[model samples]
Target chain A: MSFKDILNSGKFVVTAEVGPPKGTDIKEMIHHIELLKGKVDALNVTDNQSAVMRICSMAVCRICLDHGVEPILQMTCRDRNRIGLQSDLLGASVLNIKNVLCMTGDHVLAGDHKQAKPVYDLESVQLLGVVNSLNNGKDMSGNDLRGATDFFQGAVVTPEANPLEPQLIKFEKKVKAGAKFFQSQAIYDINRFKEFMKYARRFPVKMLAGIVVLKSAGMANFINNNVPGIRVPQELIDELKAAGKEKALDTGLNIAARHIKQLKDENICDGVHIMAIGMEDKVPIIMERAGLL
Target chain B: MIITKKRELQELMENLKNYKSFFLIGCSECASLCGTGNQEAIDSLTESLKAEGKEVTGGFVPKTGCQVLGTKVELKPFKEALDKSDCILVMSCGAGTQAAVEIFEDKPVYPTNDSLFLGNMTRFQMFDERCSLCGKCILDKTGGICPVTACPKGILNGPCGGCKDGKCEVSPDIKCAWVRIYERMKRLDKLQELCDTVLEAKDWSQNIKPRTLATRPEKKEEKKK
Candidate 1:
């Protein structure tokens, strides 16, 4: 079933992140896709995830389609002006790609190429509106399109953001701009996420809680210290520490599986979006442990 | 006011290698306040150039270096010194450098300061960029806080996923611009208006560069007559 259909079907959905290789070697990416073909409802192809330069998300999405898997084209406003963004949306539609996730994207400063210019011509909310306009047979300029797009658009939110009210305000704006679903930032604290869901449920859109599998205690501490709007709780970090170096990966996967299980059993929201950054080989194991298999 | 910072002396000297002598010009307005075009700065540069074994014909700080007509009138007294120079070094913003370019068609002109952003002097020497001058203003909707300028990404509807602790993801030192706008709007009991308003895609054509404006009155009266 299409991702949109799955969301509407009210079945507990699962999506995973797939970052394109920095270079042209797609062998590992293809392998990752093959492993996750039936495991996820859709695969979100990150556009230079964490502002690091990588192969374009569109090309990878096309590859996912070739492999008989649904792809979510993640588009960011940091690298493209309005013209470039709108044209890429059209190109995605031409390639028969359906799902698009609009994001403001990390600033170029955070990336490897710190000197590159950032083009935030449109933010996430504005980009969502642009996608809605394209779907409605009109451009952002109100000009008619000979052939309009049919994208199932989504956006992102930070449920754990310290100043949660502004993020919520922007979240509602994204909803009004026609976001069908929201795949949130990495979530580690389930109770806090549940509280956020309580407020988010007021909107009609589906919420996919983001679950990033921690690789180790050190990685969790790095995220807590560096990554904004995400807090990996102390007990989880200590749990990974107790697991030792070799066992940390398994422990992390188990932790992720536990979150997914709890979220699914509690009927928290719509589903979960798992991000196993660089650990794609372990996602299936995570799913199996979560009883998803 | 437009902020400016001095270019490195070595870099300026490398650019001035071909010139045997120079006539320095400074501005008394924003540049003077910024210390880039003040009399003391000119004297220091004069000393530095002399130490480098280069001739300094003359130097002066005008009331407003960018005022083409006024600068032209003020420079008449230094015509002989100007003619003796191989180049003119403008110790002000790019506009001031261009003013010298317009005046000295024969002599080469170079700017000694890089014109930074349009900002306010928050403290004695500290400046903060407050306006991006995107042509369109949405300050009314944002309760007077400009996200376009303050937000590192300039997100219209933001406090993007990167906002943490009411601070920007780029740096903890910088408060998230959208958060400030939200707090201000809430204090004014205009959160409803903030929520109801969905800012459309910006009219980027309005921000097209090399922008020009002449605020003269329309010729309606003359045309009617």
Candidate 2:
């Protein structure tokens, strides 16, 4: 079934992220696709995730289609201007890769190429508007297109952001921009997320709580220190530390699984978008542990 | 005001290697306040060039280096020095460097400073950019806060998923532009307005490079004819 259909079916939608390799070697990526094909509703191919250079997400999305898996093409405004972004959207549509997650991408300074120019010609809200425009058979300039796209557009939100008012304002803007679905930034505090949902439930859109599996207490600490808009609670860190070195990975998976199960059981939101970064192989384990399989 | 940072002497030397004698030009406006094109800066460069065994023909700080006609008139006294020089080093913004280029057709001109941004000097030797000159102004709608310059990503509808503790993801020292806008709007009792409005895609054609504008009434009258 199409991702749109799955989202409309009221079933708990599961989406996982897959980062393309830095080099042309696709064996590892294909292996990931093979492992994750039927497990999740669709695989979101990241666009140079974390601003690190990688193979294009469009190509990986096309590859997923060939392997009988739905693909959500993640596009960032950090690298492409409106022209490039619109052109890529048309290209993705032609490739039959419809699901798109618009984001204002990480800064170029955050990436490997610190000196590279950051092209944020369109931010997430504007990009979502652009996607809606394309789907309606026009470009950003209101010019006609030879053929329009039929894209299931998605955007991102940060429920855990400090000074939550700004994020809430932008979130409402994203919804108005024609974002059909939203995959949020990583979430750890369920109660805080529930509080955000109290406001978000008013919108006529689907929300997916983002889940990033923790590998260790050190990794959790690093995320708390470095990652923006995300704070892993001290309790989770203590739990990971207590799990011991060898079993921490399993502990991390359990934490992710527990979050998913709660989100699903409580109908907190529509679904979950798991970002098992660099640990795509462990996603299936998380799903199975969550009773999703 | 235009913010400028002086280029490294070693790098400037590479550009000036082929030239023997040099004439320097400085701006008494923004560059002076920036300490990049003041009289003291010119004297320091003169000493450095003399130490490097290169001849300093002469130099002057113009009232406004970007005013082509006035700068040309002001530079008349330096004709002999300019004639003797192989290069002209402009110690101001890019506009000042281009002024030197326009004034001296034969001599190779180089900038001694990098024009960083249009900004205000918030403190002694401290500057903050408050405008991006994006051609269109949305300050009235944004409670007078310009996100195009304040936000590193120039996101119109932000803070984008990277804001933490009201600080920007790019730097903890920098406050999120949207948060500031939110606060300003709230203070003005325009929070509901802020929430109700959704900014459309920016008309970047207005920001197209090499942009030119003439605000003179004479030009408008001539165009009307």
Candidate 3:
């Protein structure tokens, strides 16, 4: 079924992320897609995540289509301006790719290309407006299009970010800008997520709780210190630290499964978006551990 | 006010090597704080030129170099020195340099400093950019902190996912501007305003080049018509 159907189906949906290879060789990337063919509802293909140059997300999404897996084309404003973004949106529409996630990507300095120029001509809210405009048979400038798209677009939010007021303000703007669904940043604190959901429940759109698997105590600490909009609790970090290096991976899987199970059991959100980073193969195991399989 | 920084002394001298004499113009405004244009800057340039066997026609620090009419009124007494100079070396910002260009139509005007941006004097000799002059102001929405100047990516909504430890992902030295705004709003006990509002995408077209504003009142003759 299409991603939209799954969203409206009133079922606990599951989605996973897929990062394209840095080079032209997509053999390994495609294998991950095949492994997740029927395990997850849709795969979000990242666009040069962290500003590191990689294979195009559009190509990987197209490959997913050919391999019988649904793809959500993750679009960021870091590399492309308004014109390039509109062209790519049309391109995605013509390819029959139904899902697109709008975001203001990471800064270029955060990636390998520190010297690269960043193009933030349109941030997440503006990108959502463009999607809504395109769906209305017009472009951002009100130019008519010969063929328009019926894209099931989504946006991202950060619930556990420090000084959460701005994120809350932007979240309301995203909904008004035509965001049909939302996928949040990595969240480890269930109470915080539930508090955020108390506000989110007022919106009509579906929200998927973001889950970044912590492979070790060091990994949890790294995200807490290095990654923004994410708060890995002290208890979780200590739990992983207690598990020695050899069993840390297993412990992480158990932790992610537990979070997923809670998010589903308590109906804190509509679905869960699992980002294993390089461990796409372990997603099915997490689902199985959470009893979703 | 506009902040400016001086170009290297070597580059300035090379451009004016052909001219034997120069009249210096300085501003008492922001250029003075930056140490680019002031009594000290003029005296140093005068000494450096004399050391290189160049003649100093004369120099003065005007109260406001960018005010064209006011500067014109101040230059009345220096016509003799201005006429003797082969070139005008302005130690103020580009706006001040252009004012010289208008006053001395026949002489070549060179700027010793580059105009940076509208900034705040955070401390002595330390300046911080606070506005982008986007032709519109949204300081009310952000509690007076500017996202355009603070964010490396200039994302209008909020902090990007790259922020870590309340610092910008681009550089740890750069504190996340949005995070600062959030804190300030919370301290003021108006956090609900931040939660309920959403800043729109910046209208870049408003910042189009060569922006002009007419803030003066119209003539009474025009008003009567």
Going through the candidates in order, state the TM-score of chain A alone for each one.
Answer: 0.98, 0.98, 0.98
Report the Cα lDDT for residue B85, model 1.
Answer: 90
Q: Which rank order by lDDT, best down to worst?
A: 2, 1, 3
Candidate 3 residue pairs in backbone clash: none
Off by over 4 Å in 3: A115-117, B10-21, B49-55, B68-73, B76-87, B104-107, B140-145, B150-199, B215-225
**Where is the poorest 10-residue window by lDDT in model 1 chain B?**
B157-166
Top DockQ hit: 1
Q: Which whole-number lDDT from 0 to 100 does residue A20 have in model 3?
A: 96
lDDT per residue as tens, model 1, A243-274 = 99999988999999999999999999799999
Query: Which candidate number has the best TM-score?
Result: 1
Candidate 2 overall lDDT versus native: 0.92
Residue by residue across B1-225, what tens digits does model 1's lDDT show? 878999999999899999899999999988988999999999999999999999999999999998999999999999999999989999999999999999888879999999999888988878999998899999988999888999999888768888777888788899999999999999999998888888876787898889989899899989999
lDDT head-to-head 1 vs 3, winner: 1
lDDT per residue (tens digit) for residues A209-253 in model 2: 999999999999999988887889999999999999999989999
In each prediction, how many residue pairs overlap at the backbone (N, C-alpha, C within less than 3 A)?
A: 0, 0, 0
Residue-level lDDT tens digits of model 3 in B85-200: 99999999999999999988899999998899888999887888888887778888888888888888777766776666678877889999888888888899877887766666
- Order the candidates by DockQ, highest first: 1, 2, 3
DockQ, candidate 1, comes to: 0.82
What DockQ does each candidate score versus the true complex, computed on alpha carbons?
A: 0.82, 0.78, 0.49
Q: For residues B18-82, could you state the per-residue lDDT of candidate 2 as single tens digits?
A: 88999999999999999999999999999999988899999999999999999999999989998
